[model samples]
Target: MRATLIYGAGDVRVEEVPDPELREPTDAIVRVVRSCVCGSDLWPYASRPATSEGGRIGHEFLGVVEEVGSEVSGLAAGDLVVAPFVWADNTCDFCSEGLQTSCRHGGGWGQDGVDGGQGEAVRVPQASGTLVKLPVGEDSELLPSLLTLSDVFPTGHHCAVTAGVDERTSVTVIGDGAVGLCAVLAAKRLGAERIVLMGRHAARTDLGREFGATDVVPERGEEGIAQVRDLTGGDGTHRVLECVGTKPALEMALGVIREGGAVSRVGVPQYEEGPMGVAEMFFRNITLTGGVAPARAYIEELLPDVLEGEVRPGRVFDRTVGLDEVPIGYREMADREALKVLVEP
Candidate 1:
């Protein structure tokens, strides 16, 4: 078997690794069919210190079940399933409350001796709670779209859901990455009438329009904020989805939101503090929310739409790579040469 490893900054390698085995009764082994590079993966690619001993990487994938633990029920060796970025026991209190990301018994991929999703196979913990069966076969054309359920799509939906988007709401989504574009689609699906996408790239913003963005602001800082405000009749917007986890994006989010609007950020924050502390959020009566999306909780609800071709969030994947091409895939994403890269391992 071959899996991806990060030796450090700009160092990505795919090498032969030990095949995964069931380590717990709640575990199952999935032979990965489709996976992809996430924007968040770039943080480590850019800043992680150099190391000779690399660690496992990647977190989103779907595949056929190759094995299941004795205690893992409702699954078999041939079931097609998708694994969310986190493995959570759906029976936990947090999971019951629809916060699978915080499940008491759950953890992330590529840690704790678990295999990464960007590989030939992965050992999924809490198998019954984590892996959702797919109605489509291994060869379905919907594989790419269905794969987004593992992370990006659900994350975008969480951003919209947390912001309370509806037909009456006008939204401004920051960033044109996969998650940002998906946020636009999610907002549209939830009936947001006016969608303003803040992105500098024309190609990505073009897809944002297809996903239902009514306006695109390609500027940055004050100029971008002004453009968004102008689009919303000088009122900013009812909600703002901050998909870029940087100080500037946060500042732009607070800057372009209506006084009473809420800002939901699903992007992994790169900064510890920002402009939303007291002056912006407190005095303006604005709400700040959003965290790691409980993607496991959203798969079932979003699956039907993907199956019916109502939403094609997979369009965000503009490139594809084999297991061996993952390093190049990372470079392409880092260089902005690819929107997202689908790894077919």
Candidate 2:
């Protein structure tokens, strides 16, 4: 078997690795059919110190069940399924409350001896709890969109839901990355009447409009703030979705939100310091929320829409590559040459 490994900054390689097998009664071995590089993966690819021993790299994937452990039930060989980025036992209190990301027995990929998702096969812990079966076949045209349910789509939905977006709320989404664009889609699905998407790229923003953004702000800093205010009749939007984790993006989100509005951030925070402070939010009467999305909790809710072709989140994948060409995929996305990269193994 071959899997992606990161040796250091700007270095990603697909090399032969040992095959995975079930080590726990709750585990299942999945034969990966589709996988992709996430924007978050770029952080490590750009800054992690070099190492001679590279570890398995990747966390978003969907596949067919090749085998299931003795304790695993309601799933079997040949079942097509999607694995959320985080693995958890669905029986936990947090999972029951729809917060699987914080499950007592949950963890993410590339940790605790678990192989990452970008490979030929992966050992899925707590298979019954972590894997969502798809009724469609392997050759279904909806594979790309179905794969989005594993992470990005639900993450974007989390941003919108946390921001308190509703039919009467006017919203502004910061960042035009895949997640940002998906936020636009999610906002529309939730009945937001007005959506302002902040993005500089024409190509990506165009897709954002298709996903239901009523306006696109291509400026930054004070200029961007002025533009958003102007678009919202000088009052600013009632809700803002922060999809970029950088300090500047966070600042922009704070700046364009109305005095009584909220900002929901789903982007993985990268900076340690920023304008976020008690006085800043207190004076503005703004609400700040959002964190790692509980993807498993939203998959079932969002699946029917994807299957009905009402939302095509898969269109975010502007490039495709084979397992061996993953390095190139990473470079393309890192260089802004692609919005998203899909891997067919």
Candidate 3:
């Protein structure tokens, strides 16, 4: 078997590796049909310790169940499924509370949770808990959307949920990345009446509109805040989705949300004690919530939309390359030359 591995920053390669076998009765082996490079994968790609051997490097994927462990009763060989970025036991206390991201028994492939899915075939632990069966037929065109269920689609929906977005909410999404664009879709699905997207990229902004972003602001900093406020009748949006895990994006989200509004931030928090604009949040009495997206929790809710073509999240995929081209995809994404890159393993 061959899997994508990054020795360190800017050193991604596909190399032969031992094929994964059932190590636990709860595990299943999935033959990956499609996998994707995620923005979160870049954190380690850029900053993992040089001495730390790069591990398997992907979390989102759609695949066929090649083999299942004895304990995996709900799934079997030949089943097509979407594996969420976070692997978790759906029965855990945290999972019951809708925080599958913190499930105690499962973890994602190549991550703290378990092995990664960026290979020809990989191990998925707690199969029944982590994998969602897609309703599409074997030849259906829902593969792209099914692939998204693993991460971005659910992540976007989680951002909106954390932000408390609803039919009456006026939402502003920060960042034009895949997650940001998905947030636009999530906001619309959640029934936000007016959605504003703060992004400068023409292609991303256009897709943001297609995903239900009613307004687009190509500005940054205070200017961006002003633009969002102006669109919201000078009150700022009632809810803001912070999809970019950068200092600037966080600041913009905090600054642009209305008083008492909620700001849901799902961007992997990269900075320690980054500017959350506590002063503004405190003065305005806004609510703040966001964390690793509970991708597992959202799969059930959002999968139907993807299956029905109500939301075409595959629009975020700007490029598709073979496993060997992952290095190029990483560089292209890091250089901002592509929005999201899908890899066929």
Candidate 4:
């Protein structure tokens, strides 16, 4: 088997690795049919110190069940399924409350000896809880979109849901990355009438419009704030989705949100200090919310829409590569040459 490994900054390689096998009764082995590089994967690729022995990389994937552990039920060989970025035991209290990302027994891929998703196979612990079975097969045209359910789509939905986006609300989504674009789609699906996408790239923003962005702001900082405010009739949007986890992006989100509105951030926060102080939010009467998305909780709710072709989040994948070409895929995305890359193993 071969899997992607990051040896250091700007260095990603697909090399032969050991095959995965069930090590727990709740585990299942999935033969990956498709996987992809995530924007978050770039943080490590751009800054992690070099290492001689790199670890497995990737967390978004879907495939056929090759085997299931003794305790695993309601799933079996040949079942097509999507694996969420985080693996959680659905029986935990947090999971019961729809917060699987905080599950007591849950963890992320590429940790605790678990295989990463960008490989030939993955050992999925708590299979019954972590993997969602798809009604379609491996060859289905909806594979790419179904794969988004594993992470990006659910994450974008989380941003919208946390921001309180609905038909009555107006939204401004920050960032033009795949996640940002998906947030636009999610906002539309949730019935947001006015969506202002803050992105500089024409190509990506065009897709954002197709996904339902009513306006695109190609500026940043104060100029961007002015643009959004002008679009919203001099009053900032009622809700804002912060899809970029940086100080500037966070600042922009707060800057353009209505005084009584909320900002929901799903982007992987990259800063150490708080992006906004207590006084800042207090004075504005703004609500700040959103954390790691509980993707497991939203998969079932979003699956039917994807299957019905009402939303095609998969269009975000502007490039594709084989397992051996993953390093190139990473580079393309990192360089902004691609919006997202789909890895077909």
Extract clashing residue pairs from model 2: none
TM-score of candidate 4 to 2 decimals: 0.98
Query: Which pairs clash (backbone N, Cα, C closer than 3 Å) in model 3?
Result: 107-113, 109-115, 109-116, 110-115, 110-116
Between prediction 3 and prediction 4, the one with superior lDDT is: 4
lDDT of 3 by residue, 60-176 (tens): 988889999988988989998889997888999999999997898866678653557777887898899989998766457778778888999888999998889999989999999
State every prediction's TM-score relative to the real structure: 0.99, 0.98, 0.96, 0.98
Mind giving the per-residue lDDT tens digits that candidate 2 earns over 11-86?
9999998899999999999999999999889999989899999978898999999999999998999999999999
Residue-level lDDT for 339 in candidate 4: 94
Q: Candidate 3, after superposition: displacement of residue 166 in Å?
A: 1.0
Candidate 2 at 325: error in angstroms?
A: 0.3
* Candidate 3 stretches greater than 4 Å from native: 274-278
Candidate 4 weakest ten by summed lDDT: 272-281
- The lDDT for every candidate, in the order shown, is 0.95, 0.93, 0.87, 0.94
Top-lDDT structure, candidate number = 1
Cα lDDT tens digits for candidate 4, 31-89: 99999999999999889999998977899999999999999999999999999999999
Least accurate 10 contiguous residues by lDDT in model 3:
106-115
Candidate 1 structure, TM-score to reference: 0.99
Candidate 1, 57-172: lDDT as tens digits: 99999999999999998999999999999999999899999999999999999998989899999999999999999998999999999999999999999999999999999999
Candidate 3 clash figure, as a count: 5
TM-score of 2: 0.98
